[model samples]
Target: MKAFIVYCHPSENSFTRHIRDAFIQGVTDAGHECVISDLYRMDFQADMTEAEYLRDAHYRTTPDVAADVRAEQEKINASDAIVFIYPVFWSEAPAKLVGWFDRVWSYGFAYGDRTMKTLNKGLILCSAGNPIDYLEETGILDSMKKVMLGDRLTGRVKQAEFVVFDSTSRENPLREENWDKNLKAVYEKGKSLFAAK
Candidate 1:
């Protein structure tokens, strides 16, 4: 299967990077083609401008936005699966990833009247500093459900899996083995979903 991985970490050596790499490797090892969108390396702009909003309003697509939107759409359209890798900042995705949603997943592209009938197939790989239980107990998961699932991401993807890791452990828990296990679980989940049809 073809897969797109949107990575949104700012630091190269961060735990987020490790988790992202592990997930990528898992998908690749499963014999899937991987397309990565490294937002930080690309220096993607997050804030939507009045001009941009106007373009969206008028459907005057920029050549650059048009090309990128096409590329992203192509990946989504061609792929049998999709993945998002990022670190949670303030309980949400980074500015660049959010910007990606604004720019790439524009109206008529990711959603429109036709979208209520069809959705893409994909998964999400998110690594956070806090523990999974903490995030769940504190309503972070609920917020994500509302934003990524209940809101924009809803009806866009037929299926999605959320992977959260505890990075703030006093003892470094992001060891090689732990990473392997984490990524394996994600891969297994994807495999099950992809093979269901």
Candidate 2:
């Protein structure tokens, strides 16, 4: 199986970066292919031009999508699974990633007589500064999942999963303590990505 990993992070020296690497390694070790779109490293343009806005906001369904957005759509069509790796910011993905959805998920492609292929899986791996309990207690976790799985990924993939590695704030002792465990868990996720349940 082929996996398209959309990794969005500004810094290389981050736990999220390590998660991306480890997940790729596990996938490759299991003999699955991997392709990555490192948003920050690639300097992907997240902002939509006026033309784009006019097309999408009006549900124009035009084929005149930007080259970058078209390229991202092609990647989605070519892969069996889509993996999103990032750190949770303000209870959501980074602005760039959010913009990716805004632009790449175009009218003619992701919806409205869509040409986008339904993938085998869509998985999200995000790190959080606060504890998981805190996020859950505040209903932030459910909200995030509803947006990602219920909205963005629904009907786009055959199956989906959302995971959070919480208590990752630099000052939180759990960051160091759970580092290895989290990485291993994500690695396992990669290894088992296409395995029969």
Deviation in Å, model 2, residue 74 alpha carbon: 0.6
Residues 1-76, candidate 1: write the lDDT tens digits.
6777788888897766776666666666666677787888977676776766776777654433555656776766
**How does residue 165 of candidate 1 score in lDDT?**
64
* Residue 104 Cα positional deviation in candidate 2, in Å, after optimal superposition: 0.4
In terms of lDDT, which candidate is strongest?
Answer: 2
Q: lDDT tens digits, residues 68-122, model 2?
A: 8888999999999999999999999999999999999999899999999999999
TM-score between model 2 and native: 0.98
Q: What is the TM-score of each candidate against the true structure?
A: 0.81, 0.98
By summed lDDT, the worst window of 10 consecutive residues in model 2 runs over: 61-70
The CA lDDT of each predicted structure is 0.69, 0.95
Name the 10 consecutive residues with the lowest summed lDDT in model 1. Answer: 111-120
- Which pairs of residues have clashing backbones in candidate 2? none
When superposed on Cα atoms, how far off is each prediction in RMSD?
3.3, 0.7
